[model samples]
Structures are given as C-alpha cells and as structure tokens.
Target: MSNVLAIAGVTRILKDMLNDALVFGNVDQVMGTDFAVTAQPPDRIVSDNPDTQTPHLNLFLHRVTPNAALRNADLPTRSGDGALQMRPTLALDLHYILTAVAAEELHAEVLLGYAMQLFHEMPVVPRESIRTSLSAAELAGLGSGLPDFGTGPLSPAELADQIEMLKITPVALSMDDMSKMWTALQASYRTTVAYDVSVVLIERALPVRPTLPVLTRGGLRDPETGRDPGVAAEPHLATSVPSLLSVAAQDQHPVMRLGGRVVLTGTGLDTGDAQVRFREAGTDVSLLLVPEAPARPDRLVVQLPGPAALPGGSSLAGTPQDPASWRVGAYEIEVILTDSEARTAATNRLPLALAPAISATAVAGGLARR
Candidate 1:
C-alpha cells in the first residue's frame, strides 16, 4: 500500500508524462514558442495581464472519490475485540481538470488537443515512469515536485509499487457541470478537458493482531473409541478464582515444542482481558501472553514463544520474545483474568513439559542404528 504522498505522486507523474510528451513531440516547434505543464488551481493560473501568460497546460485535482471496485475490499480490518486484523487502505479516484491557458486565439485549443491526444495514446502510466517522476526533484521546469518540493529526497516508491496501475480515462463533463465547477473555482472557463486517474491506494503499516498456527482440527480423538471428544461445558460449583483442571499441547504430544500452542481446560477461565502465564518451574520469573479472541469460559488457547523469532513475534506486546525466556524444561501454566473493576485474579498453576525442536543442520552426523 502507498502512503499519504500517493495523491501528490500521481499528480506529479501525470504532469511529467505530459511535459515529456510535449518536449519529445516537439510541440514548441509547432507552436513557435515555449510551452509549460503545471499542477495548479485554475483560478491561480489566470491573471489580469493575459498577454504575459504562456501557452501551457495545468493539471488541477478538482475532486477525489472512492474507487467503486475496491472501496470496501479491506473491510473488517479490526476484530470484534478492537484488535487490528489488517491494515486499512484508502482507495481513491482522482478527478482532474486539465486546463489550457493561452491569451492568443486557437493557442489554448491547440494545447488542449495535444494534451488530450497524449492521454488517449498513453492510457496507463507505466510503473517505471511513475518511479522516475516521483524520484525527480523537478517536473517540466515548472518546479511541480512533490509536496515538500526540494527540502530533501523523498521515498515515494510505495506509490509506484502499488498493485493497481494508474489509468487515465476521459470524463465527459456536462455543460452544467463545467459551468458549476468553473464558477465555484472563480476562474474564467478556458479550453478544459476532464480526466480521471484511478486506484491510488494509501495505507499505513500499523501493527496488527498476531494469530496462532492451526494445531488440531475439530477436536481430540479418543484412542479407544476412535471418536473426537469435542469441547464440553461443566457447571461452576462456587464463586472463586479461576482454576485449571488440565494443561496439554494442542497437538496432543507428550512434550510441547517452543513454538507450539497449548490448550488449558479449566473452570471460569475466560474474561474480557485474559492472559496465560508461563512461569519457569520453582522461579518467580515468568511471561504472560494474551489469549486469542472469541473468549470461552471453559477453554483458553495460548501460544508459546518459539526457539527463534517468528514473523511479527515481537508485535504481540511491542516487546521482542527472547529465546532465553523459554527452554526445555517444566513450566507452570496459569490463566490470569481481569474483571471490569480492574481487579486481576490468576488461576492455579498446572505443569507443562516444553522441549527444544531439533534441526537436521544442528546434528553433527546422521543418526546411526543402535
């Protein structure tokens, strides 16, 4: 996704493309003078002294609307618990009024015709052209660089690298529409053509909620009965802190791996804010992990830190998980529940055996038969 500079980047690319075409097409030789391409308001282009204004084309972004195809593509960006699931994007279609400014008769018409032809010939802006336009410090000798306009070098590659290639389409503006727009801008109506540059996506790289890998599907299968034992509910006997009945790896292995997930079956285990505690056996040092959403009162799923870093592993709480925090040993697992009153209570600790995952590269030699 692109950043906030995407809009300005698109405008810059269009202005530069037109300016280049004019230069290569040698419109100056045909018109017998210098021509300019600019990105400015229509009102700002016109002046009291008409003779001083040069024959030029001005790109003015008159309106911005959402792209109909991708407007709602990134919906449900956040989970029910208000955690960000994905980065939201703003897809936009830029409506521009390309106005030709020339006091002499037929000069504006010539410039407008040439600009329209250029847009028609080249419908889509090439990705490399976009990169070159945004990176350059100037456009068409008009000094219409990006917004900052020469403070320092800008990194607008995201705009160029966006998935949707910017396409130029002619917009047929009715006579009333043109009259209303020019009147609103308070500028004299010149030979103007409307165009739409579509699908400029702008999104920010915000941290999102990390999810766990799928362990077991459906439920644990009974060894003797060969039937899955789905989740069951048990009545809470009394009002007290949450208590754990059993702790097992979701994969049903004898020992849990560093990066594996564990399921805690207990009573009164769920709350709005629930964290699973993994304490090193016989030590006060421990780590707390927030459970995934869709809270359940009888079950809690928690992921254990891996032996090495994983994607977005540090984004859980903005703290990197150190491999030293977890090792091949016994850990006492418990669930901490926080109530609406801001009080917290932890459940009884249950034992879990965590083991180190062996790698083929780490082995000194191939295994030999005993």
Candidate 2:
C-alpha cells in the first residue's frame, strides 16, 4: 500500500543503515579513516585516482522483477470501457549488488563482510528503522547521512507506512551470471554480495466504482401470499433431464422474424403448466409465450405476436405505432415448467436470433410500399 517512491525509499534506507552501522560500530575509528556508503552503480564507482577514494560501500540496484505470489492479485480491475473498477497494486521484488571499494589491502573485504553481517543479523527491516533513517536532519541527528539532510525528493516516509515488512535475503549467483554481470558493467570486480528485497507494493490512487450491497437475496415476497415465487427447486437427474436441442422457425429458417411460428425440438419438454421464456441477450428483459393446446412431449409450437393481436391470446404483442416491447436481437430461449403444487423447473437455455419484420421501405428520392 505504498506509493511509487517506495522503491527509491528502500535503497535510501539501506544506504543509511550501513552508514550508521559503520560509524556507530567503530569500523571507521579502527581503520583510521571514514567509510562512505553510496547507492551508485558499480561502473560509476570506478575513479582514476584510487588513492584519493576513501573506503566505500556501494548498493547498486541490479534488477527488478514481479513478486510471483501476488503478481495477479488485482486482475479484472477495470471495466469494459477502461474505467477503474477497483484499486490496482503492483507487487515487485528488487535485486541489489553490494560492493566494497578501497585502495589498501583487505579494507574492501572487511567492508563487504560488515555489510553482509549487518543484513544477516537484521533480516527484516524494522518500520522504526526506516522512519528514523529517512527522517530529516532536524528530527534525526546531524550525522544522519542522506541526500538533502536525509529527506530527499523521493518522500521515503511512505515506505514505513506500508503493510508488508521488507525482507532482505542473500542470493547465490552462479559464476557464469557473475561473469556476465561484471562484463556488462565493464568495471573491475570488487568484493560483492547479492541481496534480494521483496514485496514492494505500489498502489494507484484513483476513484473506484463500488457496487451497492444486496438488500435481498431474491425478489420481494408477495404482499398477500407472503412468499417469493422467485425461489424454486429444480430437479437434477442423470437421465431424462430436460434439455433443448434446437429452436428454429417453422419453415426451417435459421432466423426467427416477427409474426412467425417457431418449433422447439428437445427431450422431456412437455411438463405441467409449461411456457417458453425468451430472455434478451445483455438485458434483463424477458417475454413468456404459452404453448398451443395438447402439448407434445418432444416438441412445441409458439406463435410470435404480429403487428395486430393474434387470434389466440399471447403474452405480448407489437403494433405498427408501438413496437417497444419487442426488440430484434439475440435472445436465450428456455422452457419453464411449473406443477399444480407450485414446484417449478426450467430446461437448458439455447440461443435464439430474433429478426425484425420489414413491412415498408423508403429510399432517397424515392418511396416503395410493400
């Protein structure tokens, strides 16, 4: 839950930690010279005048990789139109190489040993240590050795407030990898050790669209009946389960048009008080149609309402002036069966393409009537 500055904050904290340890642990006093801690690249550490260069410990961030455990934790965080649906976080792991430099013999090795020991003794960086190391000179002591009196432009205090603690562990590099890394740097190899810092979470600060809590599990109960018809117990059987094979127009046309009859071919379709349900795709609108009398077990016929009301009663109808209730698009067709005892079950849903009926046509500079 930190900001983008967390990565730089980590490097700054490590540099300060080493600087403090060297000064307070009396390593510089025993060596009779000051030991400097830097976060510069290994190639940049090389200087022409080695005698003037003091004993130094450099922390170079070599590579950054995604944390495997929480890499995809924030998937599907955006909507179809690319609007923010939820807050997204980036989890990362940082790899660094700690190298020591000195002109005198054995000084570089001693510095490297101290740096490794400091990390080993404190495997996990404490929140208090981070806050203190990144604090300003007025808040901390003047000896606090960081750019701009400890609080740089990176705003590293955000790192201390993160939820996950930073862990430092040693990484074993193969000789081939070491050789390639040095060759890439093009600098003389010094006493170096690799360390891994993990779980730096950088989150985006943006408004998210949150859904309202559900007030009811299903539809509201009837005022008089005190029961919800939306609840039903559907039967699941290994054999003789109601399923739809195909739904096509009466003339075997692939598309169904207004004022046309469609035949439903399936098994176990005939049941108590059965009706065909049409659900428009991508919408909650539904239309129900009653089957013809003397229903067949494996087939049923339903007539779509025309511009005028049909002879037999139908659930819905469309007119030339008003066709709002009927939309020409794809729909899901399913058979709903309800018994006398109010027990209801539905068959599998299949796709149904509803086509618009063209009764008249008008073109530019001309008009035609059908």
Candidate 3:
C-alpha cells in the first residue's frame, strides 16, 4: 500500500512563496518538494534500518473522484481500519494549481497583477481588457466578497460631463469696440473725466524721490529732524493725493440712453458739494452743471440722467452758419471739489468734442453709394 501525508499548511506556504517571489527574483527552491514535504533531513540516516538511509519523503496527493450509480453487485465494505480502501492518484503541479486558483478568483488575479507590477517591477497590463474577459457572475462577485473594497462614487458619465465643462473658449474684441466699451464705462457713471495735465507737469518737475507728509502715532512729525542720526528712514513723504483724469464721451452716438458709479481716491480733502459741469464745446463761461453730489468729504457719489438727446435741430453738415454744424471743441467744462475750509481741493478741467449725430437717411445713402 502506498503511504500518503496530507500537507497540513500548504496554503500558508504557497501564500508566502508568492509574496517572496514578488519581493525577490529567485524562485528556484520554491518549485521544489523540499518546502512542502515533511521528513527527516537528507544528512540523517536510520541506524536500525540501513536500507532506508534517508527518511521517506512525505507527499500530499489530491485527486477528484466522480460518483455514479452502481450495478446490482454488492458494494465494497468499509475497512475496519480508519483508512480508505480506494486507489490513490498523483497530485498536480503546484504552479498549475496556483494558475487554476487565479483563474477561479478573477479579482485575486487582478490584485495579484497589480501587486506584482508594484513590487516586482513588472509591466502593467490595462484593466479594460481584463474586465471584459471576466464572466458576468465573476464580475458581479469580483469585489463583493471583500469586506472593505468599494466601487468609486462618481459614474463615468458624470466624469465625462465634468471634463467637458472644464474646456474654455476665449472671446475676442476689436479696438473700436474696446473704445466704445470704455466710453460706455464713463457714461454709465456721473463722475467727470478730465486730462490731469498738471499731474504730468508736476511728475516731470519733481525728483525721483520726492518728500511726502509724515504721519506718526503721536501726530504729524516735524519735517526737519524726524529720525535719529543712526536710524535709517524712508526718503519720500506723502503730500498730494494721486488723481487720474481722462476724457469722457457718450458711449452711443446721440446719447440715447446712459446710466453706473465713479471711484475717486484722495486724502485731506472733502468732496462735499462736488459738482461736474457739462457745456457745449468751445464755450467756457456758459457751462451747464450736468450733475451735483451733496457734501461727502473724501468720497463723492454722483448719478447722471439717462436717455439724453442731442441739442435740437443738430445738423451733420459743417456749415458755420448752422449752430449744430459747429462741431464741439476743447476746454468746455470742469469738475470741482470743495473742502470744509471752502478751499478748491481738487479740480479737473476737461476738453470735449461732440460729433454730429448721424441720421438714418445718411446711412441709407452711404449703403446706396457702397
């Protein structure tokens, strides 16, 4: 009778072999029976049994037997000894068995592949084809047996939508359109736009590092000796408030509609009762106060009425006899700000030019000419 030894811990040994194979490249001894078979060492010999110098190699053999109905003959009786009387079969190779196990556990195969790639420096195989190769039942049970593994939160469609929304397109604008936009910006606000020629002149006259007013915790510091001899000090002091001025124009020709806010920055000056006057070009003395804001020192808020129409009976023809034909010229109006001391804290003198309103008839004629 052939003796067989059941491998008590083959599963754990196999798992260790797989883990070590991922960490180390040598698999020479892993394939040998020495790791699985339990027996005396090869160097040891039995003293009483000289013929059996080395111990017999214990082997674990497994075979699948099929059950079927037997004919009317008497069946074999069980042996009195607790051993089976059935014939034994050879076991399959461990590597082949492991391959079969991986095929049976598809998710384990994927996880093994990923682990091998990470630990063994193996090339990665794409997951899509592997997923497609799995059967419906196998795919359903892939991650279900695992206690903590989870399918991701976002669906493929949602990811695709987010990716599509991330793409951006740039918008382009022409110079004339940009100018019109700036004009609209100024027209939307009631504040005056003027050329600060005085600032430009002053900047040209002053040195690179100019003196400014000094403010201290105690109060304003004395100008002559504000710092100790050994201490470093700032070169410039704050004096006049920086102001920006520019020409303002109606965004749309004929000023059909207009209505937005003006931002001003300054110090030591009150804008209480600040007024912006708009006048016909070329006339200085006869100017109309277009808008006015009640005393609010340091900041002024103003609003201009909308849907302004050109002066009545304006003509496009440049005839000197026609008041409308006389195009608007420079130095027409000014913006003035008054402080508590009744002083003119800030002033912006603006030069303006008004273009003659174009009529529908002229547009039609121009199209005909074209």
Candidate 4:
C-alpha cells in the first residue's frame, strides 16, 4: 500500500519516463513547443491569451475509480511504538487522457502516437525505477497541509512497495465517449489516447490503533493461597460484566436495522429477573435505551422500535444522524441478572450492531447507498 501522494507521484513518474524515452533523452523536443507534460485538467490548462499558448502533452487524469475487489484492503503493520496499526489503502484506476495540443496537425498526431508507443513498450513500471526517480516527499506526500497519512517522513522505497507493479493499459473509448470527453473539458479535440493506470494506492490519515488499555491485574490470589506476587495469569476475568460472542441467528449476521430483528448470542446470559440493556458505542452513562426482548440463557431477541411490546411498553428508534441513534452504529449490550431476594450481577459488553447488515443486502441496492 502506498501513501497519500502516490496518485500524483505516479503521474510525475510517468512524465519523467516519457521524457527520458524521447530521442537522445531530451525534455524540450516534443512538437517544437516546450514539452510541458502536466497532470492538470484540460479545463484548467486552456487559456484565452495567445501569448502564453504553447503546444504540450497533457496526461490529464479524467477519473479516479476505486478497485472494487480491494476496496477494503489494508496493511496490518505493528508500528515501532507497539501499536497494532491498520494502515488502510484504497486501490484505484487512474484514467488518463493523453491529449496533445499543437498548432501543426501532423505534430500533434506524432506526439500522441509517441506517448502511446512509450506506454505500450514499458507497460509495467518497475519498483527500482519509481524508487530512483520519485523523491520521498513526492512519493509519500506533497505539503505539510496535506496530512492524509499522518506518517513521519516515509522513505521513497516504501511508496507503492506493498502493491503490484503499476500497469499501464490502453482503454478503448468509443466515438460517443470521445465526444463527451472533449465536451466535458470544454477544449478543442486533439489527438489523444485513453490509458488506465491500475492500482495507485492512497492511504487515509485517521488513526486506527487503540491497544488493550487493561491487562492482567498486578497481583492474583492463588486457589490455595490468599495472594501471590507478579501480574495475574491470563483469564483473570471479573464477573462484573458479560462478553458477547455474536448476534443474529447462529451468529450468521452482525447488524440489525432499526425496524429489523436480531438475536443477541453469547454465554452466561442467564440470570434472575434477566433483562438486556443497550448503550451507545463510545459512551458510558447511567441512562440507556433498552430494547424490549425475550432474554434467554444463551440468546436474547430484540426488535428495534415498532409494534414490539417492551418491558414497560417502551421502545425507541433514535434519530438517524446521531451515532447514538438506533439507526446508526453498534450499541453495546449487557445482560443484567438481578434477584431482589439474592443479588444483582451484570455481564460484560456485547456490541449489538444497529445498522450495517452482514448478508450485505445493504450493499445490493439496499442501505449501502445510504
């Protein structure tokens, strides 16, 4: 996976490659005008003034479409600081229109053909080439303002290091699409070829590492002795809360919509005067939104507010935008077993997914659009 500037870096690297591939490896030779190879949009490149006009090769990125198969691809790297950092990466297809603008018609055709020829011959961009050509700042990121990776001075070699060799392939554009392309750019049609650069990785900056805040206790009492030295052995769990294994029937799903029903599956759920409690994900407050459900020994069925009869004939479907809303994210669930004559005990946290569906019906013209 590459850093934030990998996309722009790929464009710069390509420009460099084509310039080097030109006859005698010269930069100011294409079409007698300055070989101005730019990645900017054609709309922004065009100007009304004739004095500043110059023939050039514009490798304009018309579109950036994400690769569906690797949409959620990530790198699980243990940071030097011991944080289990999940470095996220998005695979994308860079659609570039290699447009050649020249006063001489023949020169424009020659420039476009040469650009196509270069890519056809060197279809695969080598790691060594990208590593040697692109600087660390260009490969990792551009400016201090763009904190898209939150990483500190990543090396050039690490850019596009985890992904496959960047492949350049010609994309067939019909006459209609060609017309639309020129129309959208609001520029005159020029000799051009559409090419797709596969899998330029762009990583996000948000932190995804949060280590286990609490470990084993400092001292643990042995079964025979009252207490012992050193941290307690693993599985030194206190029975103050419950731990949930999963949700949905047979644990096949993890999400349930506001009006949908789901099964909260786990262990140690049985208790006197048993009732399941719901709390928002990232919050610790006394007030909770409890869903009406039939609490059982191993499972509890809950239906988000509708025609369901709750303990006190109360049900709720919190507002949509609020993360604490029943329509939003995961809700932490706990089973409370309190016997007035005996004692009261609550289990560990078990998150009840409020919205995202597991069968992914949500993605298939479902809530995925939302």
> Once model 2 is optimally superposed onto the true structure by TM-score, how far is the C-alpha of residue 167 displaced, in angstroms?
0.5
lDDT of prediction 3: 0.30
lDDT of 4 by residue, 121-143 (tens): 88999888887656545434533
lDDT string, candidate 1, 1-370, tens digits:
6788888888878887888888888888888888888899988878679987788799999999999999999998998999899999999999998999886778888888778998999899888887677654444354565455334434565687889999999999999999999899988888788999998999987888788985554445667987765544556665445788999999999778877788888778775489888888877878877777777878888776676654554554333255556656888888888876466888888898788777544334765432
Candidate 1: list runs displaced more than 4 Å: 136-143, 147-154, 211-370
Candidate number that wins on lDDT, 2 or 3:
2
lDDT of 3 by residue, 219-329 (tens): 234458773334334456744432324434434232211232233333322434455544555454343232434533344433433223445565623332233323334
Cα-based lDDT for every prediction: 0.80, 0.80, 0.30, 0.64
Task: Pick the TM-score winner.
Answer: 1
Q: Cα RMSD (Å) between model 4 and the true structure?
A: 19.2
Instruction: Give TM-scores for every candidate, taking all chains together and pairing residue i with residue i.
Output: 0.55, 0.54, 0.22, 0.47
Give the Å error, residue 296, model 2: 52
lDDT of 2: 0.80
Q: Could you arrange the candidates by lDDT from highest to lowest?
A: 2, 1, 4, 3
Arranged by TM-score, best first? 1, 2, 4, 3
Q: Which residue pairs clash in candidate 1?
A: none
lDDT of 4: 0.64
Cα-lDDT of candidate 1: 0.80
Q: What are the root-mean-square deviations of the candidates from the true structure over C-alphas? A: 22.7, 13.3, 35.4, 19.2
Backbone clash tally for model 1?
0
